[model samples]
Target chain A: MSVLRKSTVALVAQRAGVSVASVSRVLNNLPASESIAAKVRKAAEELGYVPDAMARSLKVGRTEQIALAVADVGNPVYVTMMHAVSEVVREAGFRLVLSSTGNDPNDVVELLDNLERGYADGVILSPLRITDEIIARLTSTRLPVVVIGSLPQGVLLDNVRADSRTGVDIAVARLKATGRKHIAFVNGPVDTVPGSARLTGYLAAMESRGLPTTADMQVEASDFTYAAGLEAAQVLTAQATPDAILCANDLLAVAVMKVITSKGLRVPEDVAIVGMDNTDLADHANPSITSVDLGSAERAREAARLLLARIEDPSRPSETTVVSPWLAERESTAEGASRGKNVKARKPELEEGVS
Target chain B: MSVLRKSTVALVAQRAGVSVASVSRVLNNLPASESIAAKVRKAAEELGYVPDAMARSLKVGRTEQIALAVADVGNPVYVTMMHAVSEVVREAGFRLVLSSTGNDPNDVVELLDNLERGYADGVILSPLRITDEIIARLTSTRLPVVVIGSLPQGVLLDNVRADSRTGVDIAVARLKATGRKHIAFVNGPVDTVPGSARLTGYLAAMESRGLPTTADMQVEASDFTYAAGLEAAQVLTAQATPDAILCANDLLAVAVMKVITSKGLRVPEDVAIVGMDNTDLADHANPSITSVDLGSAERAREAARLLLARIEDPSRPSETTVVSPWLAERESTAEGASRGKNVKARKPELEEGVS
Candidate 1:
């Protein structure tokens, strides 16, 4: 095994029989004579010495590594986002460090600590729950950070967000047009930013359509998991049999669809379902679940772009970019989709409605 | 934003009115005078100087990060393994760096480069194909690495492998017990390690069962994907209709199932199906596909544990651990499952066979 240690310009100088400044000139390709540069290069090659990325980063106060912290990796939507983020970072010549809040309860705390310790040049985080502590830490950290979800108004951090309100509106409108009076909604814990926004959007869409949303028409899952979706489905079905169900996320929707089918019910015939986040699972599921494309990949790419911009120039004004959500109509909601022509969502309308 | 810069031992010594060596002694928890230690700690607090993890790591040549490189993230089985690996690493107080070979074609080359640069403390790699170059680099890398697939014989390195041969035997025996005449095998690209192993296992299992293996009974998929599965199924069904089909992976099986059902074929009645990997996709598919549980999670956990052990003591003799595979019977293969009531596989026999 080769023992790797920091290579110094002094070693290159000694090997080349020149001063350290001459070696530096050769390394930087600055004004060194051809013979001296050739000797320095040969000596450096023989000694296997190159300016280390870590040492150069330490001197420039940049690590060239970016971290991405997410709530869970098991979630297909986050996995999609992570894939895009990794691609963007790699293209930008930076390494990516990953953290899952599922395993580490103190995600935000560790994130702040890593920032303070110069672990990475920037971070892109998708917090499950937006809290004051998060905002405060993000505000105080010297490193650049870009958030991938909703934040409090007027927060200074650069953010890439999704317009899920419009997503819920499109889903509810599609379901209502199918001649369904009782439409059920399944959400994750309301304390989360996504859950609460989806709930509000569902209620608003129902009210706009002159449909009443009773207590039995809505259920809050303990968490955003397939198991929780199954439990929530049982609770909603036992209380009132809604003609359609709108799930807050694709994982929950897949699970609920499984439960619905396992119980001898046919989708889009007995019950129509709509899920958010058009992940691959949505397309691969039997019946091919209809979902709202919350722009997971787009959001991640934008977040990486914003973070890179911020890292390049911290003095730039903080900007918030919201990717518009659209419905990906599939077999799950195909029954009600054609009731109204041109119901397919358009990015222009959503972008205008949200921002 | 508060400026983040590395604090020097000299700063701590100056604040405490002591020598730099004294400050180092206190920080290292060496036996120092009580008053001196107390003064140094207070001075460190006042100067906002905690021994930074990055600086300390540079001095000791250790970084608390482990890298995991996989072929694809779209595959649920790899996602399961990645989840398990992440959980283990987090519990051990180490961070995980993920690289997908699908996105980064130079994964092994970059791995070797990073090892020479000290990018990570250890690595857990699951190479889709093993080559002599990989073995040579692995032998020369200074960082500890654990491979999660089969290696060439007598190559000394920590390895965690899966025994898919027994898995295929169980699938075929179960299928034949139902009195099926023609059984088909749909495999992924034979160039891949798993694909090649599953194909070999299928042929051997068929010969052992006294069944005549025909050229028309086997089809090879271009890749282990749902689309590939659909395409392979079309080819398999168009030429000769088999009573049952065993797929190389769950994704392929799920896709084949979709095609069969869509074309007015009744699963387990017209044709039975089986999948390997036993991922969540299997359980959530319309018929809940029967699958071979390759012990992905167990292998990941064992790999992480082995890497940790090797990192703790590199002098220990290298060990090879094999995880046994088992069949998970579901609705897809329920036709002849009850003919013999002892179909639930026992782990003891398979474990002993592999070891």
Candidate 2:
């Protein structure tokens, strides 16, 4: 009501050449005449009058609430992204509802299929695992969906992705500037979307720095989660402590920080750490953390914007947008007084072919 | 204290100058800083601290379970409530099921209606927006329902409400004891049950302290949400800076703290803050918020107990219970030497009549 300018029944009534009462009756399905209902429907469709905006405008958009399905709620990255998406969705006459979709690929398909029931007008999905079944569902699902992560070859949907090269470059540049040469890279499974891009980016970035990266210098966590990071970091630490370590993400960085500290080492003092996806986890971790800003929030915001655009006009070509990355330096790289205020998220650039 | 042999862990903890929990975590192969883990391991080796026990007691035999439908998962309050309810329910030979009912009143109705399909033996519902339709649903539903919130007068359904008096007293007492007088109150919509009770309690508490109150001293948020709190706090801060501010919940308090800090004012140093509901959000917030512990954990525990009791015997007279409250004094109240480890959660003592 405050931020969003919603299409009103009065406008629909005027367009349909019917009374406002008739529009209400038709909209609410309260036994309106067939002819009146048709006219009201046409008018509403033209104006994009959100159906039954009562109950919830009644906050954001009640009848037409947009749902954002994420992989995990525990991750601070999702929290930050949710906030950004919510702001954008609310600004455009839609309320954002959240559902933490399970990690199973079938779960993603089931969620998309549930959209057919019209529970939400559209969805902004961030799935951890992508399957062929999910792609097929997306192809058939009439519901406008804007994905905030990678989709495989030839699949057309509005997508927003983080430029992994920028993240790797940012992390490497920060570590190098801080005079740390013995840097190691921890990544997720190389077969996955982010894993492949990040690992490749790490390799290229290291090559640019003329740093020799033997196979031993690269540790692969089972996943991008803290639990996976913990198990992987134990393996990494058992080998030898590097002067600097680049984690796949903030959660992994936090795990590595924990593993390092529990081994009677100081963060930054002994082992400088640079994490990707500068999430609130980085901001709140003790001694904080310097992270490569993969701009999940901005990606989410753009995804939401893209979703709304397609909802308004569904024929728009599915364009892939790449959100740039930056460095959010903090205590984990070098213990410093400056805190909280330096966290950054970069804007998106329309990129070709998911690169 | 009863089953665990603390001497070994304590000895290691004292020798390592770290927490017993840290020592336990490191030894148990849970997530802990490597430095701390290494120190604890060294200490354990030096003291020859071998864990004294191996066998763990396991509870079994649950024929049925209760479902707890919470309003919002985004708020950490529901997580705390769920954990408490689960423990209580499990102890009673019943598993706890969880359903996140959206803010929509229809969602609440739909959730309650779904219970008719023989989902669970009972339900513990913590609804955000209570409607007359909801009241009717609660009255007519065949499923035993325990509400961890205020019910309308005379509609008794095993209601467990937070003792607003204790919460207000604890907040006011802590603020006053710390020499804050010019305290402002920020509340949610007064039409809501908790909002009404908290506002009345706040006003009455201020009067009891012989402190003058004015219309400007009270600000009403549209909802008990972070966004609403942010808007309400912007209004409050624009009016004037108070010596201290009391919020309806932890979310509002966090919002107010942000507003204060952004205005170049330091918490507790420039203005103290006290919030109701000692959720993990308060714990993780910067300059960690001191709050009136409304004992949501206790309320949920009672709610689970009530639901189970009603399920066991339908002839039992429905009762209302009031949970006691306390102050979780943190950095927001006073910049104290003791930090991080002093986080407390008070157990419930159910009193009568909601006062």
Candidate 3:
């Protein structure tokens, strides 16, 4: 017969010269005698006893396991968010399970089905796009789910979305302040949520700034890849070159920087650039790409918290939270024509006046 | 009583006007009448019925789920390898359960202990570092495990490792062939397995080429981060400037590229850069960094296969597989230093000498 080692609780009880019941009570933070608690603590320290959370969770019917299903795990922005989520989850005494669905709706459905098998107490989904069927399924699930993007109307669910409108507004405002009237918008896959949202945000921001939204100023990338960004830049620059360009993400911005430098165009002089997501790549990129922070970490934390809340109270009303985005001005947009003596400078005004 | 939806198989059988056994046999690809199979297939298609592999695995006393536990999920190289592993796992009709241990040995122990609950048929562990205690626990587990890196000597465990020596050798040879005699090595923490192996590989490669391996030529980074890489480059460049620099990973190489470019040093003309891992960052860098392909995808595929083999037959002898690295020459290398140029230049000398 295979022999199993004694558990830490048993060892603590033996070392403390106390009953196993008393040790258990003290360990579980239940009402116990002060003398017994002191003895158990000393014994645990001597024996180097560490409580097994998994076993405790099993008895409580709560695994303390949360699942995060993402469309593309290879993206650095998503990877950073996942890292932040893991840190928060670990600090909260929970385990995280990650699932990569590769930007496919069917794969997302399959991942949701797998999550429904009770492996995780709650789930955080970052689907590439939202559909009616997906929204309905999410609404009906018994487990807690926090989506990492915007959802359609009439389907109540916990959501944490990035305010790309504010992000694009800042980018456009900065560009206009830099005396850049002709600005271009480079986007990735309009069918995707971020792509569509960012595009709409750019258009609205440009219109609010009294800048003409022209067809020639908008360029859509084949995909959210560096190569696609490079190819899209070639097309965008072939026509009238804009004095400033706003990218949907940092990858495209980095690619544009490469192409612009190779073509002997000086950044912030010939053309300024701004990107979204503010990923580590942006900070490490040449010129240290100026980007907008979408509060990805905060969004991840909020989603995890919402999921945990719903897991604790399933009958609670679903909530949607929107995390704001901020501008991170770097070398890419440091000094432009407006900063020089060639353009007029505008005085500081109210935030509403700019937006 | 709560109402539950009918099983897909039952729905398919009802739609086909056939017995449920016939539908089950057809779904399982078992021997069945041609008419019955045709009816079942049509009915399943009409009802959009998809088989639940999880339920079947449970009935057969197997979960058909494999866990992949890594130290850091945010690392792009790991993410790339995970994509490949997921592809292989999904193709084999098995689900993947991913967990991040965050480079903590305690977390590693906890994750492994949790895996013993029989949720997954096997596990793939990519530990940041190997310790005796970890090795002991891994050896004691009945579940099949495939480690991504080296294991302790004489330990019977399957593993897949990258050939860092060959990678460094090829990088050094390419730089030397391009008339770059002075080379520098920028590495991450020497305590890490990859970091130490890469440092040793650089030293061995330099010695093989009869080049001086001076202390000033090697700069150890504080950690595997872009900031550390930037600081390491500053230290390396402060002493004597090397004609070529080899980095431990693509992220580090990108940092070096950014730093060197900012300092007015032209890549390939003033300094050539070569990085390990051949990640997407390398291809997207300003000069399209030259890197050594560590065969991460192949390694992941091999690890999955080894895990499946061990799961099928527990008594089989453990094996270790090493994947050879290859040089991916891009624009980052010196001009006219392509593989074609190297082969052509070497062929004439060999022919003349032999003749």
Candidate 4:
């Protein structure tokens, strides 16, 4: 709603010599006495009074549409999440609508603000970035929101988060099992939430292996894209050849594979590759990439379940769910058990619960 | 809104000896004559009058959201369409929301019915199935709708269509140019619109080449999925081997590649393959698959534009746009000029306009 210097109907009521109800009735074009309506309108015009249009729109009858907002719609992880969330939301008798909130925290805030329009009963937000403004909006938003990623400490909300540190450790352990002595981590920008967590995981995993965990062992890409991965992998290859490389995502893994092959090196033979976010890209990859399944589908399902539960009873306590990660060992790792060997394109894996 | 025998305020007026306006005023909690208000309220209680909840929710105030409904959100084609649609709608100062209406025509009809709640100003529909019920809903919907796929001949709405026949012809002609006499067309369900049109194109191209065009030369998958393609391709290979094959979509082509390679046949050497839609899977495929670019992004952009135009002026005549298809040559076809060699992840191709 647009505001004109805090002009309100209450001010019009005072000038009109009438009650606030009379002012509201006149402003909303509801039934009013002739003299009272005329006096209210004249006073309102003098004060330049404008109602809060956004607040008015917020008044809603329960529309069954539930919104899911993600940073990048193109990411296969989100696609997996979307597919799962769609299924659960549909089963619960709510239509799922997806909103792409680009990689901007401000855009996320704006999206949350617009949700007050009440088209959707609730939203499942998987924001890549979190800002103070976003927190402010989320804290104040009347719509039920269940976040699908990490949140700042102390600001309580229903959240579903994956164990990225453990995800990286699984990738590292898988590579170590194949006797890869020189393991290097290829990461996206360390400034990002996932990027930073993954880098920390790499260091922790190396320590667990009783190997030297240094900054030099990790290379950073500008972004989590195939091109950026190629550029960063090129840099890592020039510095020193590693027997194994852990990519942050599937696209990065594909790029690293292309680079390694172009340099006359074979995957899992000369250099084993492990990818994060066991997306379809990893599944369909040639000699399929070994990746960490970070429970994208599980996270989405839990988030949707939390949202539905909260919608059923908004008084329910804010909850935080940690979905565990698993290793999807494929042909990309030497002698790895491969799901790709199956002719069926997709198989939903059985998940185990973790506290 | 729950209906109680179509009881309305008019009926309350007749029962209470009050004006319809006075009855409405009382029902809506507006100002009315004291005796008339009491009488109307009593009549309403006796009649069990209930309002239309859906109709009441249909009242909108120019909400900025525009919805795009697609059959499958997992398909890369829809992802491409969604990305393009999002950009255009955002540029027009509107938020793009996605609704995944499943493959059922009844689902699409129900979606259209629910859309009367007026959350979005307009919609861009890309339905896989065309049914009478869906057509009726589209025709009668108050929300401005633009279709992104083929509609029935007489049923008119703002429409955007791709030349699937032309897309297939280019693939067939390309294979023929490479001196491949035995060309087989691998398709999804022939009952589908694109499936039927592509099959016709294959026959026409074979006729143009003065070659036999028969059911024996073509194979049909149960559905447009990698597993289905593998099942159908296995059937095709058992009967007879074709030197070149044109697939309905990228998944099928990828599956065909796997089948051919499993039989110790090299791609573009012994069994050349071409896929349609030119999705990311085709781009990133090993020895990347040559594919028909069906202009999914273009179709979406045109669909969004048409809907926006209609929203601006409801009286504007319904329009149709035919986006032409092109070929993205890669290593899957013999002597095919490759674009996969580019290191950059994505490079949008130059588009030629078609009337």
DockQ values, each candidate: 0.38, 0.04, 0.50, 0.43
Q: What is the lDDT of every predicted structure here?
A: 0.78, 0.74, 0.78, 0.78
Error of 2 at B293 (Å): 9.1
Instruction: Put down candidate 3 lDDT per residue, A153-216, tens digits, no spaces.
Output: 6668998989988899998998888667777999998998999999999999999999886888
Residue B306, candidate 2: alpha-carbon lDDT = 84
- TM-score winner: 3
- List, residue by residue over B1-355, the lDDT tens digit for candidate 2: 2334556556778999987656654654545678987898788778775532311111111115467777766566876787788678656555454566756788788776655544456888888767999999998987888888888789978999988766886788767766666789999888776788898898888888887778887999988877788889899888855778999998888787877777777676667888888976676565678988888888988888788667645657999998888888888888443222212211121111111
2 or 4, greater by TM-score: 4
DockQ ranking, high to low: 3, 4, 1, 2
Candidate 3 residue-wise lDDT, B1-355, digit = tens: 0122235556777899977556655665545689988998888778765545523532345555788988777667787788777778776567787888776678778888777765577999888778787888899998899999877679899999998878999999888777666789999888777888899899999999987768898999887777888998899888767778999988889888888887787786667899888988888776789999999889988999888767655778999999999998888885653222223213343212211
Task: Show model 3 residue runs off by greater than 4 Å.
Answer: A1-60, A336-355, B1-61, B336-355
Which ranges of candidate 4 are over 4 A from the true structure?
Answer: A1-60, A213-217, A336-355, B1-60, B213-216, B336-355
In order, the TM-score of chain B in each prediction is 0.77, 0.74, 0.78, 0.77
Worst 10 residues of 1 chain B by lDDT: B346-355
lDDT for model 2 comes to 0.74
Relative to the true structure, candidate 2 reaches a TM of 0.54
Q: Please tell me how candidate 2 rates in CAPRI terms.
A: incorrect
Docking outcome class, model 3 = medium
- Listed per model, the TM-scores of chain A against the true chain A are 0.78, 0.77, 0.79, 0.76
